[model samples]
Target: MAVAPQVLPHTAISTWSGFVYQGKLALYHCLKLMSSDYAANRDLKLQLESQDDFAIFRRQQCLSMHQVKAYKDPRFSAYSDGISTQRDNARQRGVALAYFHVAREVTNVPATFVADYGPVRFYTYPIPPDAAGNVIQSFCPLNQVDMFIRDELSSLLVNAAMQPAWKNYIVANIQNTLEAIVNLKVIMTHSKIHESTRHQTVIAASEFIEFSELYDVIEANDYAPFENEAFFLSRLQIDIGTYYQEFCERQDSLSQAACQKLDDYLAAITSLNVEGMKAFLRATMPHKKGRFKTLSEFKDQSLDRDAMRLGMFTIFWKLVQTARNDGSDVAFSWLNDGLFYYPTGIHHAAEHQESICHDIMQQAISEDVECLFECGALITSAIDRPSISDVIIGIDATEGVDTAEHELLRENRIGNYKKVAMISLNNVPESLKDAEPD
Candidate 1:
């Protein structure tokens, strides 16, 4: 865990920076173990040095720290797309030896220690071994590794920054380490979820947390995270899906509606062409073609947008049908992602929002539909009452029009009234409000 400032010179720093930023040097390079004596100090040292034996893989322009002339590979690099581990090389033993505790804890991490690395706060919890195996011979690799990583990060902080906070102790580069651990996870989880899935780290979640925390710290002054909803939403949705899946699995029946949907979905799975089936599916669920802003539009311009949503929904519904027809598993997979699933990725669930929309519309009807209707009638009444329809006559000014920017009110030149307000076309039948006269 001993880490001292490597004393990277200014020129070396600039060169390394350019190499990393330009994608020359990947975050990690695989190293091999030296001799059979994994415990021997000299063996471990030689193994770590062996990492330099292989020419680093990259395009020719990427070579900056090269000590030798460019040499072509006798046999191409073993890994193509990022491989977790290269054939155990002697050169990597130094890292292994230095990070041996990291290796130990990988096998012996404790449950409480893992929880301490709260996914929410993302502050890593490290557990280092003070004394070796107890007299009882009980060992927790997870605890050992966490402690090692935590301690190592603490030491690195002394050199990395002038004043490193507790936050810096949780390293972001641990994804590679984690991925390797998950793949090499001989360690088991009691949770019903697949060990692979339960532990699989999404890089984006880290980015989101880092960006969010960065925003919180620096937001008061000048720092603004350029990343938008898309960056956050994709990862958030994955988390949501994972959580929902867990909830569903934990309970015998997660939701009656979900169960019914699955049942209907299953029943319809066989008879793909039935309109009765499709109709039932349409009634019970949301589809891609039905994407919408809101069911209750208070503006005229919203109709086109809603129409576009409806069109997307139609495409989504059929797309869902097609995916279902092709394979239910595929349909579920796509639904989980909110994508069209096969090709289009048109966000089809928006199309069938009515399933949720029905609840909203019903609440409006049940609460105060009559009072709403009556109040609206008074303002639009052609006969009795103080109707503001003809009150504001001969008005030519557009001063107050800015408030109606969304087309909640339509401009109508009715005879003497140059521009009179009328309820927008897409709004409910409830906008006939009494207004001031000109």
Candidate 2:
């Protein structure tokens, strides 16, 4: 159902936090922040799910709001003590509603209840649930969530962007979150596919609506939240092509809607200028001085080996500066697409005809994507599968540029260096460079 105008409505808000949220929303007029700093503590989440911890969660939320209201108790309303007293009713109620994440988990708060009037108005109500199959714990208000997390997550991400000492921990958490969100989408897709196939086999047509209302508040972020790496999509995999041809017809019909959505999205993305669009084209690409001097210069370029290393830090900083000042988290999902679409982006020794992996590795290391270290006794490691990548980038070679790799190369590393992956060794040939150990 379309959300009523009251819950996160479109009017200009008046509360301080609401104003801040508005300010951030204005800043990122069209951006989404997929944080490199998002860390879902499963242990903590599970602990929050426990019946014992419900009170703590509620208390934290309620007290936090109470304190906030008191501090910013500007002359907004007359309800001196209640949540309605705030300048922005939706903003205050939002925080209060989230406390229901606790109430629904621990107490007898039903997920949805009928608020009956003479008209029997049925608003989407918050119901309580136990730790088992709990949805409330996972319910993050698309608008309210990062308002609390921005500062903490930004500090963490900026630090990690610099390749912090605890970068391994951060990378592991990020990967784990990615896996969880991806798996969640997969699970949702499978369930939808099963339901869809069954419905098609039995009935003529059926539609499955979802709690995608969350996708509504994510508008300021340009619905980019829906395109998130972890977005929940219901993929219907009917036997599209079959001897009976019934499934084929069904797929053909559905493809119309799907293709239209895809076209709209693609068109929106294409509106970016040449340089902005090229970042997504490849990871790293070299440019000649005068070839299409401005970003308007375009050429039909195929996939290249060093594509991942092609972009600069300033590009991401531009996006970040736009996002942070406006008010959105950096969407790190772009990294996933980069990895999948440009698998061979990492610099390879054979491709470039030189032992550049040492330089890349040095860069990844100083920036905190350090794969391994030959410590006193134990083999110290930072990231997962860098050992595998060491082989791909040819960084494991005992000979070739071992002792003299430039440390300056390390400082040049940019953006989530820990997640840096390697692809093919289609680089320079054997006579590319002397295997100098200087």
Candidate 3:
């Protein structure tokens, strides 16, 4: 019996993430080509233009460049258009044209060279004709030594699929890019205070979150529900009311300052004032840095903040379920006072609380659980600067809290924690540790 040809999995290039992955894959291929070229002749210094996804280099004092594209289909018109555009771009960049595409197509119009790289076929354009007006044969390199290097690099790209380490590197990069985009969108949409500052903060937070594991947990847990803005606000309003009523019932057991803080939170939630809510949380939360603070003090405060945020997320998730479950229109407060008691037992208290406030605040705020969760996570990750493992551990430890609320929080926390933990460098596939990209 004849063996069947193996079919490689088709990756969609339509979605934003897919498009980015395709670009990165193309870059990876180009990088391999550059490395191979360097190995052949160290004098040939090749540089890749990341912005345009093209390789440009000075060969024998003449500029030569290759633009790369990955296409799923062999549409002649699309291919022709891409070639023309890339040629134009190369001309503008002052370089010779050698366009590369991942797709394989047998067309009569252009001088093309085809080479197979594992399961994928790469087509290079503008292969010069011979003196007799005959085109160079496909897969036939003008130079045998250059072809050998090309084959080697191509094999490496193909082998990347077979190697766990290379696979992890590719997957991690794609995931990190997608996460950064998600984080930026979340921060941009929800942040209403201090436009310039917020923009800068969002950029910084996004850069940090792109590589960090915190946003993964926030994203996975649906803590930033940008899509369900109205529903989330309504549910949050209801949960806040419920929390306020509960607080009143237990006012006798709580301290005067704690009760006052709850009253402030109640007022903020009732009015749908995000700044006020932020203030309430900031004042109550114990994650601020203080003068003359010890290393132990910082770590303890960070752990406490992480736990409280995790617990808060747990409460938020419960409220979301409640909203989904009978379409509960009843108003109840959602913020858990159990997570943080104000003015007492709070470490690293804000020294200049009034100075910390931003003058430019959102007049009207629309927020979901995700936005709330993202804000806290960003603040902790960017400002607190806790170790990734410490943050994960702190949040994960919420699983052990004895209270019913903490139990509810713990169940969801475990899953989110696991999801984020898997992406961490220490927890990623062992092969990833050894993988070095071309």
Candidate 4:
């Protein structure tokens, strides 16, 4: 009887981080093979299974040793020269191994492994150390794998564009992969992929399918509150300045000392000093006898208190901007009381069109802006309705809203109700005061 030809499985040997790269690489190759007849011609079928911290690629029935005992054993170190020796031994036993080193410096592996075991690929995932020279070990490996996938997909997209059938198949599959990742039920290491890369990949896939629309909806759902709060704050800042200036110009009774105090109050507000703002209000606009018997009466008479009340209209006007900007078949109009034609019909529109809207909002929230929750709630009430129309948001709210709003109104003012409605911000609706973002 003739000896059988020993079939060698394609093996990837690396540490935990390297397993991430291996998994992505295997997925990429699997996609490539499925999109063409290449794998069928070679009688090969690549299947991938994700374990606890690593991934394994199964070719037919043969299971790689790294997947079973090696990855689990804490004593098993990838840096050891034994890795190279094992690779050599695998080669002799009709198995091929590719070793990936996570770090730039390879210490345990000898020069002989470098010379005989083919080129040792080093994946240097550059993660900057903190002020104390300590690395964030959790993010390092994920970052490296993300960088690898981003580069691979980018190159694949460019090359796939040449072949129509291959392009269509790959694009569809990549879009599906992205959707799956986004809709993942549980949080995993893969969830921490860089936001920029995710957006780029989504945009790239959108060119071939309606994936961007879906991605935009997902992004808006995730970051709409933060984006709305940022917008509301920008509008309120302007409203506060306008009210303060108007009050100072009209009131001859406002002394130089009072003006200085008002300036200090503005600064405190800008810096997000909540206690300082409260203190200023209490000290300068406290309730008095006779005419000002209650805090509400004092608030009505005081310029600073009036300005605070006037700031509520900023939320109203921002929502008006949102409604008017919405490209819907149903017309939108602001009533005399600063309420829209269909107040219940309005919906929150995403402020930014960039795929990185979530990241932008995350950064904004991290800055710890004052009244974030309140502003977000007010904006949410204006837009979060059951019957919402088509919303079209095309402004960079991170920049000054005045400029963006002017340009937006100029371009998209057609078919909208043009009646200007002016209302005192002090008389905000009780419903709006009670509402919150969902």
**TM-scores, all models, native as reference:** 0.23, 0.20, 0.27, 0.26
Candidate 2 positional error at 65, Å: 60
By TM-score, the best candidate is 3
Better of 1 and 3 by lDDT: 3
> What is residue 53's positional error in candidate 2, in angstroms?
60
Stretches > 4 Å off in candidate 2: 1-257, 283-298, 302-408, 411-418, 422-438
TM-score comparison, 3 vs 4, better candidate: 3
Which parts of model 3 are misplaced by more than 4 Å?
A: 1-51, 58-64, 104-399, 402-438
Native-referenced Cα lDDT, model 4: 0.32
lDDT tens readout by residue for model 4, 36-99: 4422423333322221112223343222222212121223245455455545534554434333
Evaluate candidate 3 by giving its C-alpha RMSD to the native, one decimal: 23.8
Report the number of backbone clashes for model 3.
Answer: 16
Q: What global local distance difference test value does model 1 have?
A: 0.23
Candidates 1 and 2, the one with greater TM-score: 1
Comparing candidate 1 with candidate 4, which one achieves the higher lDDT? 4
- List candidate 1 stretches off by more than 4 Å: 1-126, 130-159, 163-223, 241-438
Error of 2 at 341 (Å): 10
Q: Where's the lowest-lDDT run of ten residues in candidate 1?
A: 8-17
Ranking by lDDT: 4, 3, 2, 1
lDDT for position 167 in model 4? 37
Total backbone collisions for each predicted model = 39, 31, 16, 1
Worst 10 residues of 4 by lDDT: 369-378
Q: Which candidate is the best by lDDT?
A: 4
